[model samples]
Target: MVSDAVGAGEGAALRARAVGKTFAATEGARVVALDRVALDVGAGELVSLVGPSGCGKSTLLRLVAGLDLPTEGELWVGSELITGPSAERGVVFQDPSLFPWLTIRRNIESGLVARGVLRSQRHEVDEYLRLVGLEGFANSYPHQLSGGMAQRAALARALINHPRVLLLDEPLGALDQFTRMRMQDEILRMWQARGTTMLLVTHDIDEALYLSDRIAVMTPRPGRIDRILDVDLPRPRQRNDRRFLEHRARLLELLHLTGGIEEPLAPGV
Candidate 1:
């Protein structure tokens, strides 16, 4: 059914070619947010971008979402150049950003309403509510839901549009450790069920390993792809598994977080 829903070649491959972004800083100075970044994500595959703060992770996600444009180079989804926002791309930020005044059902239906397709697609609102396990709370307002529940609502909202590529910008970053882990599995389930291409930006290394087929690490300021590491671990990976730990250590080293490397000793010593 998901295959039928998504259609072959409909998932959409993403390509960024020598993409760069710059912003005007204080006093006529310019800040290079990203530089010469090139990456490709296959159709229906999940990839994550992880790096230190200020490394342009969110900037790149925004570009893919069509909320922002690259100052240089180009981005493409499938065969089409990414010129502006499209329903084919759906974005979920760290914050749910649901309208406080709307019921959860209304919020999920909002996208269809915006596109003027609600008459034919209204049934999908309840379908996605069931998919996200929020059926019982359809009448509830955003204030009544917990952080995880609110995020689920947000996901259902985006997914009702059947986005070819789902752009997640730290969508689980605000939850507690346990909730964050649970939501990780929830997101994986959604990815599996829908077969959508996904690009996730996250600060959590383990989350990236758990969800992504490959992990792209970026450098600090003037962010560029430091390396793209393949995560070959099987699904339902054990966090304590030997291979998992190995990958974790490697990513930590890449991020310069483990303090494992020391300066060379003096030649005299």
Candidate 2:
């Protein structure tokens, strides 16, 4: 039985007002990735974005992280408009793009080092290593670790900055089932411990249902919010529970409407 998942605290507030993005395609064509994508994330809340392929989930995340400017509208982190990347926000992509040349500790420390942390503050790096269950692997290089371990290092790198918000771009997509489930639990624990606001973009409905306070369903290309589902099932949710199955069905239905698999196989048979 899974224990109930708990919220960290009041999450930092974020708003995307009429945010939209367009890219110049080959041969003078233009591709609109997102349109009027407006959403709010409350302080300390874990909001998940789910959608069909080409739904611009990643684009929306980038907009919130301030890594890309919206073609129109604006994104705000609290009262300030986001202009560029800052230590205030951390991002974890699907690939655990750790530095192959650096030790796990060194890679995590690089974030602190970039902020000009003094030698005395280096203890912060070691603390985060332990936080991600990588205490013994500190000196190991990225290639020496397994996929899951590397991803944990990526997570450690993000958290060491003490970011107010963590943007996860399908960080667990590459992992197998067992590892993915374990990482899911670890992410929840970390969120509980840190109380930082998180926005996760994923293709997995079960993952969204298990982790998010609310799941935003999106349509295909030029993605816009299709519907928002408030997940009421208790945390540490049981994947096999009736309530969990019900939400999963609803999410699948919405995905179907967006031209995803018309019938997603039932949960684990």
> What's the lDDT for all of these models?
0.87, 0.85
TM per candidate? 0.92, 0.92
- Residue 93 miss distance in model 1 (angstroms): 0.3
Off by over 4 Å in 1: 1-10, 257-269
Model 2, 105-195: lDDT tens digits are: 9999988887888375787776777778898999999999989999999998988787888999999999999999999999998988778
All candidates: CA RMSD (Å): 5.5, 5.0
Q: Let me know the TM-score candidate 2 reaches against the reference structure.
A: 0.92
The digit string of per-residue lDDT tens for model 1 on 99-153 reads 9999999999998998899999998887788888899999999999999999999
Backbone clashes in each candidate structure, one number apiece?
Answer: 0, 8
For model 1, the local distance difference test gives 0.87
User: Which candidate wins on lDDT?
Assistant: 1
